[model samples]
Target: MRIKYSIPIVFFVALVIIEKENNIISRVSDKLALKQTPQTLVQPSRPASARPKANVSVTSQGKRSSDFMLMKRRLEDYSDYRPAAAAAAAVTSRRKDILLLATTRTGSSFVGEFFNQQGNNMFYLFEPLWHVEKMLTLDTGGTNATAAAKAYRDVLQKLFLCDFSLLESFIDPLPVDHVTASLFRRGSSSSLCGEAVCSPFVKGVFERYHCGNRRCGPLNLTLASETCREKEHRAIKSVRVRQLETLRPLAEDPRLDLKFIQLVRDPRAVLASRMVAFAAKYKNWKQWAADGDVHVDDDEVKKLRSNCNNIRMSAEMGLRQPAWLRGRYMLVRYEDVARFPMRKASQMYKFTGVPFTPQVKAWILKSTQASKEAGGIYSTQKNSTEQVEKWRFKLPFKIVQVVQKVCGPTLKLFGYKFVTSEEMLTDKSISLIEDIL
Candidate 1:
């Protein structure tokens, strides 16, 4: 039935049909009253009523029992973690060594703004210890925990806890085994400074080890009553032996302050990056395996391995930190930092005793933009998978398959997976490596 219609008539008919179809579809949909699929549930909008309250019921000075875990997680949500102004009200009167450890792909760059904002009041250092080992590792392997401990004890008096707080411990949190197991945490060394923090004896310990002004006078008791009265050059002789080993000397000072913020990220996205750079760019797994020279044409591999190793080592260090240190620490994840960087920056601003004002928040926004524009090979939106998982299409199937096989175990630990290819899922060679590139 061929029927000819004028252009205007055809256009009117199409419009009428669309409007009718839409009306019909709406009626049908309303009548059916179909519920959304269970798997497609929307995340509840975080309204005011839905937010948790973090007000400590007790007076600021009193001991009120509350689970830190609950508070920490809720705090990450940002509504409960408002400036409280306690952070800005806190005053700083001493020099300290602040440690901010990052487990790559986390927003440590955003955290960098906290120290950067302090201007000249603080002598800020980022990943100094990490840098020392990284440069030495692939070449000399010259450094170890003992050496790090010694430097921390003798040189730096005030320790700052700027990265991941306490981590999962194997046994007693203070034991070496605990530290070893948590190779991804940071700043867990309060066991060495409890008495110094709680009692006046800390000054005595500091005097015995940290007398920068030897010209002032001898620190030893020349008059009588101490164990080392016979020691010569009393000032130099008073230096504590333990200080030579690790951070023992700095622990005794009146203001041996420990401040830190921990940044975490979902390991899945972190591991997925390997697929794009290491496996994809090189074209296949067999080629990457054959060229293991990190110093050669594999800068991305070097960076990935370095960050992974750093995360592992820092986690080890974090489990051993004491409760006192843990109290001043924060546990922030990468997801939270990206979704609401202002919230995380405000937390850091508060923790550092600086006012996190509107101006500061604006600056933080600028800093975040700068971070995105000036990142390395693994650049993406800080949290969401849309930018990170682009390798699904950018990469060839064979290479992704091989990476899934070679580093799959480690990837699982971080929570990523290799799924059946959309186009080639039924192929038997999906997970197998091709002999040729």
Candidate 2:
């Protein structure tokens, strides 16, 4: 009986030890499983304050790593970035400079009025180069063409930038502290004569200031420069620049968004008008016309040839759309503008990206519709449609023949029909201007 009882006690003790070992193994397995499980799948049973901070530490480290990576990317991108082109684009998008290029007697002054009358936002300079040309001619006797061109370009670049200091250097009897009454054609630029540059002599009268009238004092170029800077757009009408290619530097300048509008007209009409407008200078031309004998070797004939050649070459260069001139060049015929003033003005304004204000429209209507021209030889007002053909009557057949002989290429290029006789020349029914398109 004692042995049996001892055996049962041993078996029960063994069973109890086995059950305790199984509980310990199960607890170990649960701890291992919790350690291996994803944080999202695990549910904590401990009090919030008693829990381990491992997950919180991991989240803070991960956030710091992510922010560091983002900062490093931004720094690398900035290191490779360039702002030159972006800055240039910003400058061009805001401001525009226009060079209205044409030869004398091409109705350039009239066309210049288009921009000059663009309300107060526009700063227009009419023939500022006239001063440069005159001073250089007087000083050098007009012998140094290359030097003159350089000086002209330099002054123009400065003037476009509203830097009158260089231009003031060219003015005769140099401006005293940038005050000059000697600036050539100062009255022509309405901006120069406006109240900003020149205070009114008689207040509240609304009389436009005239440089010749001497009512307004000497032009304060410092004030002029200030006014120029205030304007949103600047336009310069010049008859001095002979070649379009010479202006490439101005176009390429990052500071200036430059565009060129070349105004051309019938050479025959140009000669006829020049003869009447400049009697003393064109006396030889008038003599040749009267005598019906023109020496092709004469200086006058050579001048005509040179002018035509320059026009043709420049037009060809502009038409080819050279890389530098791309979208920056326009060829406008004076006849076209005269025939359709409003339409042409709108096209020009559109090209320069300026508003074609009601003031311009009203001015065009009044200027083009006048029964007769109101001003002197420099007058813009005219019955423009009639003016287109007026040269046909004023120019003699002999002179016309001479112009045709010397300026054939220019005439054909610009769509001016050659007149075979006086009848054809004078006949209003015969259209001399062919449609350019």
Candidate 3:
């Protein structure tokens, strides 16, 4: 009877000790699981075939403790493990889409070269929307502004994604099934003219192919698409995107990390430059300047007012920085860039989160310090400092007053001081540009 009772009590005590040990192990496992990294916790379970088979059996408390420690070590290792390929892919797959948005004759082309000269990693487009504006304005008689804006946004969105199919529809003498040499300002984009798109050149050469030289054949859109895809970044310089607010949908796109640099210039300077660059179109403006009679109510004057209003409104929207435009919209004055090209370029590059490459720096140095202005009206190369005040001498007093009166709000908003006289307009002694902008 003593032996039977003793055996039963010993059995009960052994079972209690085992239960306490199991509870402690379970608690430790729970704490270890809680400490695991989010990636480890969320990672899908390994297949039964892939999982390691347990070879050691727990037969003693000491052995179980050893197993618990092994489990802890494995869990810690799993938490820290990230495949090198995945890490590399995450870094390389990051894409930046930049839009250098501005009106024509606002030094957009010059600023665009900042991105354009970013070497092979960048796929830059120069006024691809010129085709869209040309085709759409003709089709809609320039009255369907809303429709045109939507179309511009759509084409830009697609182009950012490397889809040239939508843009092809707007190309005049429509692409013969996605092939065209007639892409407007094709030579302006170095990527389009470089290898893969235009080839049979010396391998490893960095010099861009000039379309004017006709060294390459017609642009193959398919090749261009592939080249665009291969690139890590895409930049488009456009004067056609009139309103900053119109691009909200693009800023919110899931696939793109898009940024806008809205380049603006003094309206007086812009008008003066337009008068010279677009002589045929601005004949009436030239006459008005000569005659000292700018009909304030004339269609041209009203159009100027409207353009200024649009620019001012867009700028106001960007400055207000609604949720959509936050961290995405940047306002840059053409005057600032002209006065300090390198500094301004650095800021712009930093804003876009791209490296201000040595190549771009060299280009800016060469382009801005040229002895004389090179190329046509669309040329980016010039003595930048001299270029800033060229319009002061060119625009007459009457025209200045006209712009000041019509675009008063715009002038004030952008910190452009209104000149009281021709002397003030031409005076380099008195700085027309305020630092406020």
Across residues 1-437, which tens digit of lDDT does each residue of candidate 2 receive? 99989999999999999999999999999998886453222122235355323225776445434433432342233222234224435555477789999999989988999998898989999898877887777553453667777888888899889999888877887877787667777777888988788754545433332565346777888999999999989999998887777787998897888878899999999999899998998888888888888787898888888788778667756654456766676778899899988988887776676778999999899999877637767788878887788888887898899999888767766667889988899999889886642
Q: Model-by-model lDDT, in order?
A: 0.37, 0.77, 0.78
What's the TM-score of each model vs. the native?
0.41, 0.76, 0.76
List runs of model 1 lying over 4 Å from the truth: 1-97, 118-122, 134-254, 271-322, 357-359, 370-437
lDDT of 3 by residue, 52-109 (tens): 2223234433432443343234223322223422443466568889999899899999
Counted clashes in each candidate structure = 24, 0, 0
Ranked by lDDT, the better of candidates 1 and 3 is 3
Question: Where does the lowest 10-residue lDDT sum fall in candidate 2?
Answer: 38-47
By TM-score, how accurate is candidate 3? 0.76
Candidate 1 vs candidate 3: which has greater TM-score?
Answer: 3
Tens-digit lDDT string for candidate 1 (224-273): 11211121101000111111113323333444444445554434344455
Summing lDDT over every window of 10 consecutive residues in candidate 1, give the lowest-scoring window: 231-240
Candidate 1 Cα deviation (angstroms), residue 134? 6.0
lDDT of 3 at 305: 79
Candidate achieving higher lDDT, 1 or 2: 2
